[model samples]
Target: MRAPEREYDSDPASHAHSQTRTLSSSPPPKTNGYVANGHGSPINGSSKHLKSPVARVELPGSTIYDDSYIDREEYIRLVIQSLRDIGYIESAATLEAESGYVMETSRVAEFRRCILDGTWSEAEGALGHLGVGEDDGLWEAKFLISQQKYLEYLEMGKITMALHVLRNELAPLHMDPELLHPLSSLIMCTDSADLRQKAGWDGAHGSSRRRLLVNLQSYIPSSLMIPPRRFVTLLDQARLHQISHCIYHNAPVTPQHFSLYADHTCDTDLFPRITTTILQVHTDEVWSLEWSHNGKFLASASKDKSVIVWSVGPNSNPDIYVHLHLQDHQFPVGCLAWSLDDTILLSSCEQLIKMWNTESGALIRTIEAHTEPVSALAWVPDGSGFISASQDRKINLWGSDGKQRDSWGITATRIIDLAVTPDYTRLVAIGESAKDPILPPPRSDATAASGANRNGNNNTATSSPRTLEYLMIVYDLTTKQPELSVSLGGQLTSVKISSDSQYALVNHAPDEIHLWDLFTGRLARKYTGQRQGRHIIRSCFGGVDGNFVVSGSEDGNVYVWHRDRAILLDVLTGHGSGSVNSVAWNPRNTQMFASCSDDCTIRLWEPSAGDRDGDSSTRLAHRTADDRSHEGEPNVKGKGRSRESWVEDDSASRSL
Candidate 1:
């Protein structure tokens, strides 16, 4: 890598002469190395150099689609979708006409015309397409255009080119939507009904490639070029629609297209192994545990009410969630939180959310926000604010002040858990359903048929729509109304947002956990192996669609469930005589995961040798030092382990 130019920083006077690389000089990558003649193998055993990777501006407040670049309407749609993709809608005040609402109607109309006609050239020529004219706003243009380009790749026939722009062009457009990766991954995709008989993929190619070809809708610019290449674009049944939606991203690298076969060549397959250890580590009875926004600190709220903050170690344990008011909750703290900025620690007793300064351990503010017990709290990613769900049957939005901004009533019998998308657009709640299941009469024919004879043997499994079933509700923060609801029939316990906000997982009561597609509002996959009656604590995802889910169950076991074919990849044991209560992942690390249980223990796991069964093409791994700890190893017993995560404090100690 070339060193940064010292002159650029040291000599302010010479800044004018510094050669600037336009934003990201991220050229479309060739799966095969660049050759002297632009052919294969370089022919000669000579040296070649790729440019040092540049950072993508998609930074905070930079620009999405600036006036300097592309068409207006395309940019506008992208803005809407991007807004939705990022989770901003749920937590943000509606994009006021004030505060730089960049999309003008003229721009919206003209761009729509271009997309309909398949005219990137004409669109490029439009008066307001780029910012050179009177309406120039590069940042706004970037945001808007990138969003449109996303949809276009699928809508138009430019999937290959569209993805090139996203990976090679758009993502860095701004640090990338803080929450897009997660939302993108969470989109609903149904299994592909067709499979190539000859290739087992139905066409002789593969399921992944087929998915890329059909699921999404986007507008492709005729002018933008697809660098010649070939690579894999793997998609299974569960993600057929997802691949289609983001189809633009699946284009091959040309000639030797980048592989996406999910066979020894892809890097997203670690979830199975990682999930196993997480499950094993939570086998004991767990009381509770919490995750840092970056997924570092693992805090467990015990039945004992005392909270233990476990340093994910290695990384500095930023004093997170320390708050003064937290100490005042008279009841055992039922829930705790580390704010998005790593700013405040929030604790819930019955009806209050006490904000405390993690560093000073002083009470900051208290909101009499709920009428009943408060169960979950989430901070908006943009750092705009936060929302909390409570047993009071309400979700409240609170600004820095303890005052409530807005509140929405919930029907979940009680609000048990919550997850806010990174963009803050949607708040997902797992609670009772207005449409719960119906109960059968006491004596049923099914019970008699089950081979158990009773006086009138009746066992009813299917009931009414309003039963106390597990349901996921996508509540629009702006509208404050339930937009969509999905019923998953589990006694919903807890919910979590992936670091990227791609997929949200919920622990269903009685041994089944359901994974939901956040966007389309559908059940994407199902995870098995939860012990009946054990709490299915919570879950976290490493990558956007990184095949694994780590769930802590009440059976005192944390089971790692792999998606697509929802399998119990591994089982982790040890912790409390009770079930595992909570789990978290280091946002910066994919290989490392943490879990805490009622057993009063926190456990961490790493990949064995960090060498798993797959390809190594992309470089997203966070650097980690040696993290081998036999910490929870003895407890990974997976069954009847006496390990406990709860430790009772002496009354004398409490008084002191």
Candidate 2:
């Protein structure tokens, strides 16, 4: 049975009186599971004309189409409700009178009167008639009625009567001690005022009985009492079902935007595909990129040994310019992270982590704590400190001032990447463990024959192959203790947590991205089709509700997939030759995303504009080998190849 909706009786006295008057005109006669007729006349088993209520009633010249599947009675009830919803009381009453279908039965109307009129014994006896079976709901409803009666008895200064009801009536119901103890304690009140204050309920003359009636309605069946706003609920549910099935739905659904005439669906052109701007500030390969928390700026770490911060233009403008160029890193900048407030940015390279003031572009502090290259940085949700993972098998906590607050001991595996959940409850990390025995790399048959001949002539020592086992460990942020560990057998490059912190997207090498449900410690889905064997390609959760997965490929293209279906939606090609290394979706604008590449540029993408007559692919500037040879120049010095040359090379791949 469908559970009824929740709605309270607003004007209890008037509503009960109105229902009483309507049903009293022609009281329905009791029959054996048979529906009453238009004149409130019950049909017996011998009557062949009238069947059960579930059977369709034949109506002459009905407005509804005969071929339609809608039930005649249900349609009339919905019409009545729709009329009432728009404050048409007279119209609704007339429709009910003409349709000969009361919203509730005659028995239910009597029960409503008994509940509102403070007739406790009569109301309690009517519960079974209202279809409340002899179950927990029936007893629970009876307890509420008896409790209200006890409170009213005390309000009338009848202390002895309240005690008798508590001991004899409520105690025999076998309810929980927690509920019975409260009623027992209420007996100690000094007077009516004290009783009312302690019980937290008004007297019987107040709205207490009306509230009781509303609660008891849930115990009865919807056939006896219709749920409030049932028609509106059904329509809203149907609209949501349509939206859920739409693969490209990224925007919120509203009555102003959606129509009831057709099924809901969003156009694919709304996805971020067109490249509106190209940022060519970095002369070397851009390795990592991240948008600021407020989405006003974008930060990129590059192989040029520099970290550049770019300011995003306003919504009306479609341009990005270099905001700050920090050229202090000795090695290639590997990763970047932003504070929760977007005031601080951290860039990692080799064994050093640098904190910079985002607005002033001044270097705040530099800390060298890890022996190996710092692999990832994640800020604490509160902005008090940050956590950094390194390839040296260690995880360190540092304050915003670059002070080491705490450090976990060396782990068994080398930590590669880590992220702090948005809720600040858990910290997850991807570590590589080499506990298994090493096996040599497979050699070709001819190479093995040549090696054997060389070994027979002169014995030469060969190097053993390296082995690795990836493990994802989850730690309680408060206790800083490992809570759950899952073994994912793959070469993991990076990890990104969802906004709700319930799932994590882990980039797996050799062509797969695994979506893991963190709570279940299981891989929920695998997204494929992007080339990711050697280079460290990054992916992120995008779209308005994070229903899309956007990733970069070593094949110099950006891949977008539906997160729930694992369907490859688009392969965006813009970078000239080098691999697209990282992708970042704007936190503020759902229609925009950014992708950086080894082509030494950052491309900003937005939904396709209809007025733009060109193809979906963005035009890229042609570049000679000499033009890209320089490692650390802030800007390109020479004229690259023509736009036509790069367009012929970067072929756009649509949904597969």
Candidate 3:
């Protein structure tokens, strides 16, 4: 016998109060002799009422309740519907009974059961009863159902019935001829295996029926069954749309953020892999390399007295090749720089700087301003001009027309390297500082006078030391005046400023690199473990937020270290017979980086495919542990905050 349908009160507040009253230890309140119903209606025609039950509703920590947006009953209905749509039938039934919500009607359950039982006539009637419209979706669903029934008849060796079903049912649906032709051919098969081979159906009763039901749900309106994965699919589309429009999205969107509705299965298998491309056109040592701002091309200068422009393909595959080669420089090219617009290329040879048109490889301008070998070159932020430092103890600013605009001389010491901030507000130059003359001891005035008279008339004499001290000077670009000067012990080979201009990466001779805080002029951290004595090994700041420092080594390997913690991360090797001269990371594509070496080849490095399967959190934890292991012994002495103390201590230790 059919059970009577249960009735529920629509008043959520009264229902909740009744549940809550059961949990509390309080006496019933009454005004008259009669009690009141849970809905605030007086019973027995009296104005008095007993207390209602109180409900203990435990909300999630992150939930904020708003009755105006959604009422208690509506929220519970949504939950129940979601549970049933995802195939959690048992849970949905339990929730429906407890919450007094009926999400799935008897007709919907009957339709599902008919499909699973292979009762084609009942399923069709059920679909029609569910209000499926006479649209293309309806016809397409009917065709699939007819085709499945035809296959079932053939599988049971009833050839005559299979032909009758196909010719009458499937043909009347007006499906495309391509689909109809395949269904008509299924009747010629003798056995289930033959039918499965001809028509790509598995001939499985349960799985095939389940798939047909899923397909039919797509045709039926969501008001009937709430199309499977409807909430999840809509949420995914919204997230992708937002990510595509976001201005600051650096990585792909993942299912780790807050969402109203989401599927918990997230594929976190995104990582780059290395290709097999190695540029071997240069016949001599490659001294320096730089990427275009747009990351379309790579310019490499070598000791072969040539600069080769490699065209970087969009796919970043193993097909990058040389685009242009400029061989105008008579001496070996030492440094390279691209203009802000990436149209002009600058290559520095000893005492000369040549400008070439990047597109045509034509020599546009040549400036011969330095008296000695030019050691460093930096373009102004606006690309209006450039600055060149040389061993002649001079620094000159030149325009694009090859004319010197300004020139300044240091205190008789060769300039080693220079770097300008991204904003062009400050310029830092590293060079040797002038030394004070050594005077004879004051204890021998007579001996000093006798020696002076023997040399000249009667003047005291002094001698100067052979070696000068190395120092770094910061200059105000607007005023062209020295701002701060600090002494350094070892010779500085290369200098790079962070993108934010907060710190400077300075490479010292032999093997050490120091990170200096620009605002305070204090040493922030130090990186080691690279052999840098023989060549000018250039290092750069990379990673998503410039969290890593990548540099070349004389040991024929590329070394990477954490910028803040100074922990060595990777030591990549493949440079055949010489030291790695420079490493350049793609400004746009952070996954790929290139390293050029004295072996006259450029090698590309990327993450292995195996790394993609590893969890991102695990990789980060490993990196942090490595940093801790390397943090025990400080490379720089004294945790000094003052500039003087830090520099002086570092200089003294290096001198020892």
TM-score top scorer: 2
Q: How large an RMSD does model 2 have?
A: 12.3
Candidate 2 residue-wise lDDT at 223: 52
Question: Which whole-number lDDT from 0 to 100 does residue 67 have in model 3?
Answer: 37
Ranking by TM-score: 2, 3, 1
Worst 10 residues of 2 by lDDT: 647-656
lDDT of 2 by residue, 243-315 (tens): 7788887776776668988888887777777676677767778988999988888898888888888767433
What range of 10 consecutive residues in model 1 has the weakest lDDT sum?
Answer: 450-459
**Residue-level error in angstroms, candidate 2, position 312:** 1.5
TM-score of 2: 0.68
Pairs clashing within candidate 3: 17-53, 18-53, 19-54, 19-55, 20-53, 20-54, 20-55, 21-53, 21-54
Name the runs in model 1 displaced over 4 angstroms: 1-286, 294-296, 315-328, 409-413, 433-470, 499-502, 534-536, 543-546, 608-656
For residue 386, model 3's alpha carbon misses the true position, in angstroms, by 1.4
Where is model 3 more than 4 Å wrong at Cα?
1-275, 411-413, 434-465, 609-656
Which digits, one per residue and each the tens of the lDDT, describe model 3 over residues 1-656?
Answer: 01012222121213321222122222212111111111111122111122232222334322236435544544554565565455554454444444433443456556776777788998887777776878637777788788889888888888889889887898887778998887777777877899988887878454787778778887876544545455456667877665444322234344454355753322222222242246676787888889988888998888788898877644333224456778887677877888888988888877788988888778898888765567788888888988888756788898876688987755335577788999788988876544644422332343442222111111133353345567778888888788888788876777889999888888877589888888998989999999876467788987555767889888998888867667786677667777887888888776667888877788766554343334323433443221332222221132111011111122111110
Summed over model 3, clashes come to 9
